[model samples]
Target chain A: MRARVLVELKPGMLDPEGATVKRALKNLGFSEVEDVHVGKVVELELDSEDEEAARERVKEMCGRLLANPVIHSYEIEIG
Target chain B: MRARVLVELKPGMLDPEGATVKRALKNLGFSEVEDVHVGKVVELELDSEDEEAARERVKEMCGRLLANPVIHSYEIEIG
Candidate 1:
């Protein structure tokens, strides 16, 4: 199974990196870009029996190491 | 219009940050994890007249600011 996980800073959390990028874009003349949220995308191939089990394991992986729930949230896509 | 951009380090480019994360995962007991490729995902809501123009402008944004083409590749999804 293949899984793609997108982990992002939670709402209301301060993202200095994202803010810096957004400011850079604005200075670069992309004024149309109102906001920018930067996140991490992790592509992984796992040996799992089925989708359900894969999702469960992946969730555990995220909770344990991939993401910090106190400040981040994640979404998973499996194939 | 909405666009989702995924920017990744080009193949053969050394990703020290990603390697560090992978090592951390392994130490955390995710032994099944063989490899991990970490990339950036940027979600933007743009006000464009059409998808084509949006893509063009977004490409310019990536080229000028969002990504460094010297070591990165990006894919865009528009809706």
Candidate 2:
């Protein structure tokens, strides 16, 4: 199975790297950009064949290592 | 309008960060995970209303700042 995990900062958190990009864009003349948020995508290939089991495992992975629960949230997809 | 840019390292290029994560996962006992690839998502809120125009602009942004043409490939999405 193939799995993907999308990890993002919680809604109200500030993103310094993303803000730096926004500032750089404005300086580069992309004046229409108002805000920016950055996130991570982790793509994984699993030896397991069951999609459900892979998803559950990926979720556990997120909780354990892929994300910091105080500031990050993640979504898991399996195929 | 809202725009999203997904930036990933082109296939065959090495990803040390991702490889490190994979090793960490193995150490943590996720034995079923075969491979891992890490990518980035940049989400932007733009003042423009036209989705097509925003997408085009975001593509330009990707070329200029969000991605490295040599080893990085990007996808732009607008809403």
Candidate 3:
């Protein structure tokens, strides 16, 4: 099975990197860009064939190591 | 309009960060994980309401700064 975990900063959290990029874009004349936030995608290949089991395992992975619960949240997509 | 840019390393190119994370996961006992790849998601909010123009602009952003064409490829999603 293949799974993807999308992780992003929790709402209300500051994203300095995103802000920097947004400023850069404006300076580069992409003034239409209003806001930007950077996140992460973790693509995983699992030995398990069951989608349910894969989703469960990936969720655990996200909670345990893939994300920082206090500031980050993640969504899992399985295939 | 909102746009998402997913940037990933090209196949056959090494990902040291992903390797390190994989090793960490193995050490943490996620042995069922067979492979892992790390990528980036850049979420952008643009003032433009036209989806076609948003996609074109985001593609240009990807080519210019969001991704490195030599080592990475990107997908743009617009809403």
Candidate 4:
């Protein structure tokens, strides 16, 4: 199975890194870019016989370590 | 226009952050996860009347700031 996880800071969370990128974009002449948010993309290739089990395991992985639950939300796409 | 940019460390580039995540996954009992590579996903919502112009602008953004071209590669999905 393959999974792609996108983990992003929750709305209103302070994101200095993202802000920095936004500034850089403005400097680079992308003046129309109003906002920028940085997130993580984790692609996983797993050996699993059961799809449901894999989904559960990957969700647990995100909750436990891949993302900070308090400030981040994640979306998982399984294949 | 909307764009989703996926920037990843180039193959052979050392990724300590990704390695850390991989270790954490192993600790969480995802022993089947052999390797992990962490990447960035930047979603941009831009007001652009021209699709080609937006694509060019975003590509420049990634090249100049969003990613370190020497060690990172980016893919852009435009809508």
On lDDT, the leading prediction is 3
lDDT of 1 by residue, A1-79 (tens): 7888999999999978778887888898887877778899997777665998888878988998889999999999988
Q: Candidate 3 i-RMS (Å)?
A: 0.8
Candidate 4: the clashing residue pairs are none
Question: What tens-digit string does per-residue lDDT give for candidate 2 at A1-79?
Answer: 8888888899889899889999999999999999988999898989997878888899889989999999998878788
Better of 1 and 3 by DockQ: 3
Tens-digit lDDT track of model 2 for B4-67: 7889999999999899989999999999989999999898999998888888899889889999
Q: Kindly indicate the candidate among 2 and 4 with the higher TM-score.
A: 2
Q: Which stretches of candidate 1 lie over 4 Å from their true place?
A: none
- Candidates' lDDT values, in order? 0.85, 0.90, 0.91, 0.87
Reference-based lDDT, residue A56, model 3:
89
Per-residue lDDT of A36 in model 3: 96
Give residue B55's error in model 1 in angstroms.
Answer: 1.3
A1-79, model 3: which lDDT tens digit per residue? 8898989999899999899989988888899999999999999988997899889888889988999999998889899
Q: Could you give candidate 4's per-residue lDDT for residues A1-79 as a string of tens digits? A: 8888899999999988889888887887788887888899998878877888888988999988898999999998888
Error of 4 at B6 (Å): 1.0
User: Residue A64 error for model 1, in Å?
Assistant: 0.6
lDDT of 4 at A47: 82
Docking quality tier of candidate 1?
medium
Which candidate, 2 or 3, would have the higher DockQ against the true structure? 3
A best-first ranking of the candidates according to their DockQ comes to 3, 2, 4, 1
Off by over 4 Å in 4: none
